[model samples]
Target: MIPHDRPVMAEADIAAAAGMELHTWRRRHGSDFRARVPVVNPGERLRLYDQAQAAAFLEGRPIPPAPPAGEPHPDDLLSTDEVAAALGTDASTVRAYASTGYLPHGTELHGRRYWPRHVVQARIDAGDQRHHPERTGAGRQPGDPRNTAPRGRRTEARVQEVAAELARAEGEALPALTADELAQRYAVSRRTGERLLAAAREYLQQTGRGA
Candidate 1:
C-alpha cells in the first residue's frame, strides 16, 4: 500500500508501476481509474493522482475518502471559488481583487492563482469597504480625492520624478517598475499605476533618457 504522504503519480507513471502499457490502461480502465482516484490537477496536460488513492484503485480496494470541504487550514491553498465562499462574495469579485493587486500576490500553479487561506482571512479581517463603496451607504462624492483621479501639474511632476528614476535605473528596462509595484509604491490604484507608467515612459522618451 502506498503511503498517503507519497508524491502524486502521473497517469503514465501509475500505469508503468502496474506493469500495464499506458495505452492499454487508458483503453481498458482509464475512466474507472480516474473516477475512483481524484485527479490532483484537473486542467493540466498531465493529470496527477494521489499515490495512495491510485494504489487503492489499482488493488480493487476501497479508496480513501476525500478531505472534508468546509473550513480550510491556514496554510491551505485556496482557489478563487474557495476564496469567494470565504469572503461571502463571488468568484468574479475575487478575480477582480486579484487582477487589481488589491489582494496579496498568491501562488500561481496550473494556470490558476491559489491564495493561502490565512491571507484571504486576513483580508476579511481587515475589511475592504473602500474597495466596495456600496457598503458605505452613501453615493460617491464628485470632489472625493479618490474619485477625482490624480491629474494636472501634480501628476506631471510625479511623471517627471518617475522618469528621473528611470534614467537612474541601471537595467536595460527603464522605469523598472511594474504596474502592480508602482501601485503599491505610490499607494494608488492599478489603473493609476498603468497611467503613471505610460506617462513616465513618454517623459523618458521625450527627454531622450529612455533611448
Candidate 2:
C-alpha cells in the first residue's frame, strides 16, 4: 500500500497503492473509476479520489460511505483544473483567462498554479466569464462602444510597481512569475504583462537580483 500521508489520491496513486500496473488499472478501471469511488474533484482535470475509499475498493471490501457533499472551504487551495471545473469550463480556457488577466494571479506550489476557493467563487459571482452567453448578445449597431477591443490602462509607474513585485517574489525564493501570473496580479492584459515581465527581469538583472 502507498503511504497514507495524503487524504486524496490521483489515478496513478490509486494504482500504485493497489499493486497494479498503472496502464492496466487505467485500462480496466478508468471509465468507471468515478462511479465506483468517492471522487473528490469531479469534472476537474486533476480528479482526486478519497484515499481510504479507494484502498477499500482495491482490497475487495465494501467502501465506506462518503461524507455529505458541501462547498469547498473558502481557504481551500484549488488547482487550475479545479477552478476550471467550478467555472464550467476547461483547463485551457482557464489558462487563457489567466494569461489575459480575466483571472487573478494564483499561488504557485509544487510547480503547479493554485487559487483560493474564494477567488474562483468571486469570478463566478462576477458573471463575466468569456463563455457566458450574455457576452455575445445580438448587435444593433456597428459603432457600439461594446464593439471596441478591450485595452489595458497602462502607465510607467504601474510597470515599475509590477517589476518591484516580481523582485519581491524572487527574493522570497518563489517560482519566477509568468506573464499570466503578472496579468492576474495587476489585472492587465497578457501582452501588457509580458512587457512588464520583461522590464522586471531587466531590472532584476541590473540590480544583481535576477533568479
**Top candidate by lDDT:** 1
Residue 66's lDDT in candidate 1: 57
lDDT of 2 by residue, 1-211 (tens): 1112336777767777767766778777767776788566665434567777888877888889876655547767788767777887655456556655677877763235678787888889987645333334533124322223253423444455556657645433335668897665444589978988788677678877665
TM-scores of all candidate predictions against the true structure:
0.43, 0.43
Cα lDDT tens digits for candidate 1, 63-149: 997544444467766766667677765554565466446677677642345788778888878966534334444434332223344
Any residue pairs clashing in model 1, and if so which? none
Candidate 1 lDDT score at position 120? 81
In candidate 2, position 147 carries an lDDT of 29
* Candidate 1 to truth, TM: 0.43
Model 2 misplacement above 4 A: 1-6, 27-35, 77-93, 97-114, 121-211
lDDT of 2 at 17: 73
